[model samples]
Target: MSRKENAASLVQDYAEVFICPVCGDTVEVVELKSVVCPKRHTFDFAKQGYINISTRSMKVNYDKELFAARENIIMKHKLYDPLHTRLLEVIKVEAANNPRSLLLDAGAGEGSHLAKILDQMKTVTGIGIDISKEGIRLAASKSEKAMWLVGDLANIPVKDQSLHTIINILSPANYQEFKRVLIENGLMIKVVPGANYLIELRDTILEEQKRFFTNEETISLFKQHYSDVQIEELTYTKELHQEELRDLIKMSPLSWNAEQESINEVRNREHFGITIDLAILIGKNR
Candidate 1:
């Protein structure tokens, strides 16, 4: 099918999950290309295979170049393969009984992680939502058999009690919105940075010492809102070539504040070993 046709098909397939961003009314597919609510609000599907569900314009710091850099670092370098594997293991168990499970990747920038996970699972549908228009455009163009939307995390455009599994990887969380949208017994998988994450990059550019990250406060907050909370820590060091190193610096926000000279210095290195330290937190709605 063509890209426009695929996008329309996705809208027809998962129309029920969408709600009018302006009025909060349930939306239905109309003519396979637009979604309309009872209140007469309509959203059109873009030719590139995504929908814009935002009611107003909002600007963020991310851009096409950053997302492109992220895609290269993720797909070409396979930097997060281990984390992806672990996520699939947990998702397989959660979705064992229900083959047609629904998964949402909140803050799904560029949609690489969601697409990779969906490629391994059968009879499962995924939704990738992000606030950045550029990120959503890249995701819609590259990831097939999924729905993409430009929406906010604080006020998700999905209906209440609609999602079976929600994945928040290296993104901020809105627990109240998450709990409201999740089905009963739905699983939420969140990944946060650990103390040693990207130590090499930190050491390369920064002059002053910075405190290490700890998840004690975050874990405590999660426990207050969810049941059966579990946490797993993963840490490893990987060697990166010069090009991969350049993409890595471009993909991260840490380099945004650094001087051009500093960025060039890091990019010019022949090779370097960087640490990947992360914590995966899993929880179920209380």
Candidate 2:
């Protein structure tokens, strides 16, 4: 089957969870090519298989090349393998409580992380949503296991109390919308950068003030919204070759503002030692 057909089928299976982006009504799959709501707000599946479910046009800084670079760093270099493993373990604990799970990877960029997690899961239905069409397009091209959509975080396209788990990794969070879409006691696994995250790149490319990192305010805000909040700190160093180091620089926003000479300096390294320091916050919806 084509990606469009496969996406339609996936949406059909989980149509109950999706709502019309414009009218706020339940959506239905029609003619295997489009989704229509009661008020006739129709959205067609793109040729690449992902649907654009946002009400307005969006232009994001994360382009196709950026996503490609990110995919290379994550998939080829296995830079995030340990983090993915821990995410699977956390999701499994929640999956055991519920026989079947509907997981949404909010702000899922390129869907690599969600695709990897879904591969290890047997009974979880995965949905990946991002505002960047380029990221969602790249995601749809990779895996048909999850439903991919270009969506707004503040106005999520999913229905209320419908999700069993939400995984937000190194991405912004819309806590109010997230809580509205999650069922009672649903899991929220949020990963934020720790003080030493990407210290190698920061030290080389960023300003002194920008080199410092902290998530204390982020954690405190999260605690106010979630119950049974637990934080896990994962820290490690990964050795990178020249090409991997280049891709890492391309994929990170830390290098976005750096001078080309500084970027070139990091890219031209013979061997680079990078630190992956992150805090994983696991919590339940109140």
Candidate 3:
């Protein structure tokens, strides 16, 4: 099937999962090209293979260049390979008895993580949602099997109690929305930055800035919402080449406010060992 056909197929296959962001009414697939609610609110699928279900215009800071840089770091350099592997392991265990599981990646920038996870799972259907149009465009290009939508995390366009697993990787969480979308006994896997995460880059950009990071508050928040919450810390150092280093800095928000001169200085470094410290929080609905 053509890319357009594939996208239409995805929309038709998962039509029941979506609801109109405006009216909060169930949306129906229209001619495999658009989705419409009873109130006549319509959303069209992009030719490139994705849909936009955002109720209002978003003014996000992320752009095509940032997502491209992130894609390079994630797909080409395999920067998050270890984390992906661990997530897959957890997914296998969680989905062992339950086939036909539905996984949602909230704030999925470029859809790399969800795309990678979907590749390994046999019976899992994936949906990736992000607020950035640029990120969703990149995500649509990366994976046709998974449905990609541009929508707000706070007001996720999916129906309530619809998802089996929700993955929030290094992204802000809307606990109320998450709970509303999750089914009974649904799993939520959240990845948060640990104290030493990307220490080299942080130190490079702001040497004098006190490097204090913590997930204590985040963990407490998760515990309040979930019944069986577990936190695991994963840390490792990877030697990055000059180009990878450049992409890392360009792709991260840490360099957003830094001067061009400072970025160039970091880019000129031949090699830098960077830490990938993250806390993975696994929780089940209460």
Best by lDDT: 2
Off by over 4 Å in 3: none
lDDT of 3 at 109: 92
The per-model lDDT (C-alpha) reads 0.86, 0.91, 0.88
Q: Could you tell me how far off, in angstroms, the CA of residue 188 lies in candidate 3 after the best superposition?
A: 0.4
Candidate 2 positional error at 199, Å: 0.7
> Pick by TM-score: which candidate is best?
2
Q: Global lDDT for candidate 3?
A: 0.88
Question: Model 2 misses residue 103 by how many Å?
Answer: 0.8
Cα lDDT tens digits for candidate 3, 1-286 = 7676688787788778888888889888888778899999998889888888877887998888888898999889999999999999988886786776789999999999899889888888888999998899889988876888888899888898988899999999999999999998899999999999998888777646545667889999999999888889999999999999989998898887666787788899999999999999999986
User: In terms of TM-score, which candidate is stronger, 1 or 2?
Assistant: 2
C-alpha lDDT (0 to 100) for residue 52 of candidate 3: 89
lDDT, candidate 1, residue 185? 85
Worst 10 residues of 2 by lDDT: 93-102
What pairs collide in candidate 3? none
Q: Model 2 TM-score? A: 0.98
Cα lDDT of model 1 by residue, 151-209, tens digit: 88878878888889999999889999999999888999999888889988877775545
- At residue 280, candidate 3 shows an lDDT of 95
**lDDT rank order:** 2, 3, 1
